[model samples]
Target: MTTAPLASNSSPASVAEMEQSLEQLKVANYYLRVALDQVTDGVVIVESEPSDPKCGPKVLFSNAAAAMLAGADPETGLRGLGLNDLVAGDKDATTLQASLQQAVQNGGCHECECALQSLRTQAPIPCKWRVRAVFNSLRKLLNFTILISPAQPNAPAKADPKPAVEDLDAQSVQLRKENLAALAQGIAHDVNNLLGPVTVRLSALIQQVQEHPALAHELQAVFAGLKRAKQFTSQVVTASKAVPRKHEPTDLSALMRDTVEFAGAGSNVHVCVRQDDNLRLALADPVKLSQVLQNLVMNGIQAMPRGGYMDVEAHNHMVGGTGDGRLKPGPHVLLVVRDRGCGIARENLGRLFRESFTTKADGNGIGLTTCKRFIDEMGGEIRVTSTPNVGTEFRVYLPAAEGSGSTKPLSPADAAPVPLKHGKGKVLIVDDEDDLRKVANMILTRCGYEVVQCDNGQDAVKIYQSLFRTGTPPDVVLMDLTLRGGMNGTETAAEILHLDPEARIVCTSGSVTQEVQMVFLERGFVGVLPKPYEAGELTQTVHRVATMMKRN
Candidate 1:
């Protein structure tokens, strides 16, 4: 009787404890639901039917975040929905389905891009979500869940307020371009000035080389080499450096053919150009056009690693005519480069022409931008169209010859052909830099001309006066504009002109701007040469100017 009473009394106490444990469990479930609804990240729960490996997938539940992602109400969401509604159908859906199935079979899943790739591709990819598997104690898959949080794209790329380094880099690039352009022009100008007197003396010396035939032949070869070097410099100035050149008549087909050839050098891919002979003609700086074509074709070839075809075509065009090309009424030449390779992405097309934007891993990002600058300078335009896995096409339009690019004279053809110091004439080189003046003196002496040097305008004037006192002024005077003592090239030229009205003065300076070059020309200087000149250029300009003086 005592043992039975003890058992009966223990039953009610144990039952009360069990009821309290159930209430605690109920309270925990309620809090979990509250946390789910308030969470920032989307929470998706997809369970496997019958906990079987081969069972079809089913949505067990979804949190507020998940419903928001699916374009459903956050508060009263997950009533009924299909995964297909969220994931783009076809390939994307298949990939998602397979991933869900795998996660359920494995009892748990880990974060993977394939988990959210469907949403990333379709939705603007505002956030990146990672999927994980929830499993029971028996190691059986219960549900596959994913957490979604705002991704990098949603962070606003331009919102980095403290991007001092990037801002500096961008500024540096812009400054570099401006500095390069200015420096290049300055160098060209200075080169011309240095060569002015040297070229004049060389021409006169070449006339005297009639004495030693063998020596003259050797000197002629030197002159030829000098000429070639000048051409090379011209190419460099036009290519890497920014300087304007007189445009000349150019055949579009010929330009395209040469560009294709240039890009093909040492490359495995064969470049084929199909340009219409009847295509629009234009007055273009052949050198600049050459640079543009080469850059584009090279880019096309680089896009294809396995070697694909690059079709370059040219045709006459005018605005208002449809792209299909039955030309209606505009004035342009159409050059098209069609490539079969990995095409540019839709998102990337706008950035293609932006300076410093590069798709290539190793690219410096100047090729396309340079092309754009060249085309814009030529009064033309460019357009691009690309399809992923299909191909890319770049179309360039240049104004017709009659409309914009008309051929100019070939005065620059005789750019650097004369030998300095060889011509039989009196030459004067005036500059502030003694080393440069001596260099000019040596070059002119070797060319067989008597060369005198002056460091300033006052000295230059005295020399001319003394020469005139002896009844024979120099055949040519290479004058530096800024003599560093308030006496500029302009004033010096004026003083020399007063001494010898027929003075052949080639004013020189690299620092002289375009306006100053014009000033010197207007001041009656026979030629305007710049400093930083090559030996051949010096000799050539000297000869050309002296010959003109003699003719006059």
Candidate 2:
């Protein structure tokens, strides 16, 4: 009944048939690869060993098109590249990974849209991605097949093309803004590091030159310029990160000057800024206020493309009564941006601040709307007055800061510099910037503090650990969020806390996002010191943090 086990099929005919089947399989695999390479859509194969799912999926193979799409060399393909390496942001990468895992378990094709990081330019390219799970005959998971294609925007119906044009125009402008934001974020860290030392040094120089009035005045001007540069960088980061708005006493005169100068730079437009001798500080978000001013000034410049004069004026005003519904009764800082250009039509004046309402042929009409929204959020008012072919004017009224806090327009004679706070404590400074460390050391040393400096996080941890072992841990550890290599500031802080949980660490970074600061605080950091800080601020922060630690 055993059937003789198929008569032991090792004969010459059987061997020949087996060789033929093996040859056919080789031919089929070669053809499949060629077909994948010839397709327009990108094809990538991802696989993970069943025994080691924790290792996740590795890029097993990619066709020519896939290589091109992923910004890899066609000959080399994208094999062995980490999954996260293909996605642009951390959030997006996590989402894609989750989707892949779901597809593996649920047995269906999963789709998502995400920006892919291009290896050649290191730019983000938006794409539509799909993942399908592959399984063996036993239903055990084997691998995944991924298809990538460029993302296409949904268009409006063909009846009315105006909406489509407006949509495209808006998309174009948004794309440009995103690109600029990315560029700004990329350079902000380096720029802040470069400016931090100069800022601290300038503060010290001004104090040193106070004996000579004229010399101090000259130094004050340089310091003012440095502040403007820092403010610009901060505004860029604020916009890109979309941090929460903060209202504080703002020097509107300085913002006006900076915006007018920036908007008119290299342009034929003539811009003049005027401020009252006793202009009061405004209670507003300095970053958003700067943005609003920039938008208005830029609009004025564009209005007069053939070269014309624009006036930007800031003054203190008192509203005794709430006569109109537009503004509340209070002290206000009145800002005027006037342009001698082709004005809007009388009928369109009311719609100036309306969303997506544009008078220009190519305008998407979001600038004025955003300005209005931001002004309103700050308890302010914005009004527009225009006459066709005559001129146009934009008026912004911001709530004046409490008290008699009038800001003088960059007058060194009226500006009395704040003295640096003296402190006695040991501080461990971790930063990669050499000049910055030198300046920090100089400032802290003069203020009666012992300072130890290190370039990277590895050394930083080691120094702190040794200090702790010797029973003389630094009273305050100033940790920079970004380091050139090895562990970052957060990771270093974690390691230090692991060694000594009661360590008082302060997070210093160019990024001032509320979310980022909160994360650091929750991770056992006691304080935060933003970069590009003056000597006074640095000394004050260190003193306060050290004093608190001693109290604890």
Candidate 3:
């Protein structure tokens, strides 16, 4: 009866259905292989022999990632490889085997960090592994599914030589200084952006009121105050840098007289400058050196609130012969600021240049520190001598230029404004800042030029292409270096140049570093107009570029 029942169960339709089911399983397996290959981490499976579960474990399957990790052909997989082939040494293999056995006994999951040797490279690769064991209903060991990921290499142990407390303290202090300097730099960048419009508009106003004598005088005074404020912001920026800006030979005596007059303008302190006509020019950043002199003179003036005279003297010195160890062995220009006022105490003299350490009730203490930093950056030295109830003197020794003469310092006289050349073509302005664009539009439109504006580089490029195609290419394009949510100024400039080889593009940015400026120039920019540019600067830069384009 059992034989007859078995024979009746196999119809043609049922056999066809069984065949279809087997085909579906094969398709599923193919899809699974595709999915596993797409993963980035390695996946592998190993099967253990039923009779010798502890010793004979062989690779049954491996995905493409796993094969690549093992340095094998992905199509061939890592099948038929023993556990010993993957692990670095006999000890590692034994450890892996034990871990597998433990996982099988305790519900089939284990994780470990191990070194696996690459078959092709023959180098040990550190890896983290998570292994899961599959089991039958009878609790027999079957196979292991492993996920392998590259692990960070362990740092080597060092000999136990305890570091000194003083070394640790110094490290901490240095780190703190670095962090503070970084913060100060970020603040300075933002402040510069905010001050840009004010500085430019103030210059514009001052230029406009020149016909009104009284009004011009008042605006000039305000402009001077703003200039001083701008200097302070620049000082903040310099405090964050390890080195000063580029140095050129500058007349130390002329700079000293200007700083003394500026510092003692409203104070009762009568400042007098004394220097020889043959004083050699000092190699320094003119602006930074001026700021240092101003700081010293201001300190001197503040020390004498009861109206006293301060002397500023400049002279030549042979460094080693000046009786100052801080000055190197070379020719130097010595500038001294002497004030007859209550001098610094002996105990506080050593800490005078330390930031945030001051004796005055109203002092923030960064003045002397900043002066010291600036002097050091110029490859110079600053020293002080003080006697209680007598006077305090600050001396700065800067390296003297080798040559007898120097280039005249940049001044308004040197940068005499170029007359606006009225143009017949359209001007395009691309910037993300709305206020800045508006300011630019006002200036360009007032100068008898048609102005177009865009807030991003992509739109600017599109507009430029459209204009070029229509046979009305812009006479000049003012581009901002950075734009949010689109292509940057450099990319846009390149695109525009592709559209029109003779396009005149001037790059602008508030935070334009020297490197960025160089990149802009290399990318076919006609000129670079730094942000917060005055109306005259913008017009002058545009006019120059446009005139060049016309000539070309």
The prediction achieving the highest TM-score against the true structure is 3
Kindly list the per-residue Cα lDDT of model 3 for residues 490-513, writing each as its tens digit: 768889998888999998865454
Across 187-212, the per-residue lDDT of candidate 1 in tens digits comes to 55446545445544444455567599
Q: Order candidates by lDDT, high to low.
A: 2, 3, 1
Clashing pairs counted in every model:
38, 0, 0
Candidate 1 Cα lDDT to native: 0.64
Top candidate by lDDT: 2
Model 3 misplaced regions, further than 4 Å: 1-186, 213-218, 221-244, 318-324, 328-330, 354-356, 362-364, 405-424
Error of 1 at 284 (Å): 4.4
Candidate 3: residue pairs that collide = none
What is the Cα root-mean-square deviation between model 1 and the actual structure? 31.5
Give the TM-score (vs. native) of candidate 3. Answer: 0.63
Candidate 2 lDDT tens digits, 1-552: 456554565899988888789667856765787788788888888874423343346787787677766555343468777667778888888888888888877875799888777664555767788989888998887788889876766677788768867765754554455445555664786688888998988888788887898988767766766776777677666655545557899898777765666657788988888888878899998877887998998898888879989999988988878534566788888999999999988888888889999977999999999999999999899998988787899999988988855676564443334569998999999988888988899999999999999998878888999999999999999988877645568778989999999899998888665546776788899999888888988898899888884623
Q: Which ten residues in a row have the lowest lDDT in candidate 1?
A: 114-123
